[model samples]
Target: MVLSYEPSVKSRIMVCITPQKSSRRLVERGAQRAKETNGEFCVVYVNKNSDISQDLKENEVLLELFDMAQKLGGRVSILVGKKISKTLAEFARENNITEIIVGKSLRSALDVILHGDVVNPLKKEAMKNNIRVEVIE
Candidate 1:
């Protein structure tokens, strides 16, 4: 018997996340898709240090993010800077990432009232950079 196989090209996928109920779900979905396409996944946690007066970290979220990265066999990247949207966008652009997967924002009533509808800003950033972003609602 003769067997033949075709090699798959590994693409890069970037997914932005924060401390939200939907973050895990989004990462999992992104991982599955990455596996399907033989792609690399970059789980980015935007911790803009300069933006905040005091430098601190979200321990719970960071741990969970790393766990997801490990379980999915993905790369974990941390960007500490002032420009949240721009930082993420630049990474995607520099890496030639075609798609970004993110979870739907779970905003509180008060948050919505104060901040307006929470449309993931990354969506717009991706569009501006000519990169495609998918929200896992």
Candidate 2:
């Protein structure tokens, strides 16, 4: 009899970030998870407006976050889309992502009602694809 061993698949972790300083924490968490699992780490941001310069502060923060992600040995992606949740889900599927990390919603109830929730839809898509979604505070 012969015994064979097969290596497990590497985790592909995606961290979804907004243009806020708190997003750095999510990036750090993703990086840590990737390191622990010997996996790929990626940071993603979805922008609705074509002109990022419209919000100077937000743009600056996003740039800083992107730089931090790079420093942590992670790939950064800035996608333009009307729907953030759909865009994120599509990107995850295309990249063969195994896990997704997201921060707790900071939007107000009115804002959520007006714009729709990103996590729920994203979770639905992830569930259908057998992907893991983690919400961090």
Candidate 3:
């Protein structure tokens, strides 16, 4: 009998988070997927505006979430950009992220129509980079 060993591909999973408590779930989910695949986990928060002081409460919550991500063996990143989807996609490409986990969009239909849908653009970007995206409801 002969024994053979094959190295598995390592995945780099990124979780896109907001400054809300619900974002913790996304982080946990990303961590679980990373663990299952023996991959790396990362949590990212994108601020549309540079003025984080505009929302002190949200900033505090984000800090807590970052702490949790660190405890879960995940790297935490805070980015400032005008476009969320584009920023996330660029980060994914630069980081060689294999998969991205995001929560269902909280934007209203009107807002989406006026601003643009994050998931759709993100999905398009992911396709171009051969990256997978999971939207958790």
Candidate 1 similarity to native, TM-score: 0.73
Clashing pairs in 2: none
lDDT winner among the candidates? 2
State the C-alpha lDDT per candidate.
0.69, 0.87, 0.86
What total of clashing residue pairs does each candidate reach? 0, 0, 0
Worst 10 residues of 3 by lDDT: 1-10
Give per-model TM-scores.
0.73, 0.88, 0.87
Candidate 1, residues 28-107, lDDT tens digits: the string is 87788788888767787777564532322446666676687778877777677566677777778777776888766677
Output the better candidate (2/3) by lDDT.
Answer: 2
Error of 3 at 39 (Å): 0.6
Q: What is candidate 3's CA lDDT for residue 81? A: 89
Instruction: Give the distance in Å from residue 116's predicted Cα in candidate 3 to where it truly belongs.
Output: 1.8
Error of 1 at 33 (Å): 1.1
lDDT score at residue 3, model 1, on the 0-100 scale: 13
Per-residue lDDT of candidate 2, residues 17-59 (tens digit):
9988999899999999999988878899888988766754547
Whole-structure CA lDDT of model 1: 0.69
The sequence of per-residue lDDT tens digits that candidate 3 reaches over residues 19-127 is 8899999999988998999888889888888886675454788889989999998888877789999999999988788899999999899999998988889989999
Top-TM-score structure, candidate number: 2
